[model samples]
Target: MPELPEVETARRGLEPHLTGRRVIEVRLRRSDLRWPIAHEVRELLPGQRIAAVDRRAKYLLLATAAGSALVHLGMSGALRFLDAGLKPAMHDHYDLLLEDGRLLRYSDPRRFGCLLWQGPGTLHPLLRRLGPEPLGPGFHGDHLWQLARGRTLAVKAFLMDQSIVVGVGNIYAAEALHAAGIDPRRSAGRVSRARYAMLAATVRDILSYAIERGGTTLRDFINPDGQPGYFEQELNVYGREGQPCRRCNARIQCVQLGGRSTFYCPRCQR
Candidate 1:
C-alpha cells in the first residue's frame, strides 16, 4: 500500500496539471473499487472546475465548486498523467479527461483504491475521526504523550493507531522508533515525555526525508510519472533482519508486532 509520502508525491505530481483545469470527461470503467463508486462522482464530476488538489493523511482531495472528490490509492493503485492519445493498460480503470487535453488515469491491479465524494460541510466517515496529520503542527510530542498516557499497547501498535496520528505507517513507524532508540515492544504508557519528544522529531524527519526522496518503493509504488522512489536505498532496519545494523553493527532482528513485520537493532534501539 502507498504510505503518506507516496500519496503526497502523487498529489504534488497531479496538482500542476489538475488545478484550474476543467474536467471535460469522466469515465468510471467499472462500478466499484473497494466500495462502489458513488453516484455523485459520476454525476457531478464532469464540467466541474478543479479549485485545488490537497492531501489529508493518505487520501487526495480534488476540490471543486460542487464537492470534493476523495481518492485513496489502495495497495496496487497508481495514478498517472498521460497524453490524451495514450492507450489504457489492462489495469487502467478510470480516466478524467481535462480541457487541456491531459488525461489523469487510475490503475489498480488489486482494485482496492477508492473514489468517493464529500459535499461541503460533510466529512466522509473514513476521514472524520482521523488524528492530526503527522506532518502538521497538531502532532507534537505533547499530543502523543497525552494519548499514550494509559495505553498498555506496544509503542509500535500505539504509533500505528490512526486516531493517535495519521500516516505513520508500518515502514515509517519502525524507522522512526529505531531512530529514537525506543524499543518497539515498550509499553506505550511507560514511555517518557523526553523520549516521546525524540520520537516525534524522528517521525517528522523520517517522513520529510522520505517525501523528498519521493517515498520508499518496496513494491507496486511509483510516482505519477511512473518513477520508482529511491528512498529504499537509505533504509536502516525496516527490512534488514539478520543483517548488521548500520549504527551498532549488531545483528538486526525481526519480529511480528501487531500482526505486522517489525525490524529493529537490539543494541542501537533501547
Candidate 2:
C-alpha cells in the first residue's frame, strides 16, 4: 500500500495537471472499488472544476466546489495522467475527462483502493479521527510521549499507531526507530523523553528525505509518471536483515512486532 510519502508524491504530481481544470466528464468503468462508488461521485463531480489536490495521511483529496473526492491507493493501485485519446488498459477502472482533452485515470490490479465522497465542509469518517499528520506542526516528541505514558505496547507498535501519528507505516517506522537507536521491542512506556525526542526528529527527517526522494521503492507503488522511487538504496535497516550494519558492523536482525517484520541492528539500536 502507498504510505504518506507515496501519497504525498502523488498529490504533488497530480496537482499541477488537475488544479483549475474542469472535469468535463466522470467515467466509471465499474460501480465499485474496495467499496461502492459514492452516488455523488457520478452526480456532483461532472462539470466541477478541480480547485486543488491535497493529502491527509495516506488519502488524497481532489477538492472542488461541489465537494472533495477522497482517494485511497491500496495495494497495487495507481493514478496516472494521460491523453484522453489513449486506450485504457485492462486494469484501468475510471477516468476524469478534462476540458483540455486530457484525463486522469485510476487503475488497480487488486481493486483494494477506494473512491469516496466528502461533502463540502464536512470531514469523512475515515479521516475524522486520524492523528496529526506526521509532517505537520501538531506532531512532536512531547505529543508521542504524552499519549504513550502507561502504554505497554511495544515502542514500534506504538509508533505505528495511526492515533499517535499518522503515516508512520512499517517501512518508515523501522527506519525511524533504527535511526533513533531505539529497539523495536522496547516497552513504549519505558522509553525516555529524550529518546522520544530523538525518535520524533528522526521520523520527521526520514519522512522529509523520503518525500524528496519520491518515497520508498515498493513492488506495488510507482510515481504518477510510472517511475520507481530511489530511496530504497539509502535504507539502513528496514530490509537488510542478516547484513552487516553500516554503522556498527553488527549483523542486522529481523523480528516480528505487531505481526509485521521489523529489522534492526542489535548493537547499534539499543
Candidate 2 structure, TM-score to reference:
0.96
Candidates in order have lDDT scores of 0.91, 0.90
Which stretches of candidate 1 lie above 4 Å from their native place?
Answer: none
- TM-score against truth, every candidate: 0.97, 0.96
Which 10 residues in a row give candidate 1 its minimum summed lDDT?
A: 24-33
lDDT of 1 by residue, 1-270 (tens): 888889988888889888999998998788579999888888999999999999998899999999999999988899998999788888888999999998999999999999999997789999988999989989888899999999999999999898899888889999999999999999999899999999999999999999999988998799888898988998999999999999989999999999999999999887
How does candidate 1 score on lDDT?
0.91
Candidate 2 structure quality by residue, lDDT tens digits, 47-79: 999999999988999999999999998877899
lDDT at 268, model 1: 82
RMSD of each: 1.1, 1.2
Q: How accurate is candidate 2 locally (lDDT)?
A: 0.90
Worst 10 residues of 2 by lDDT: 217-226
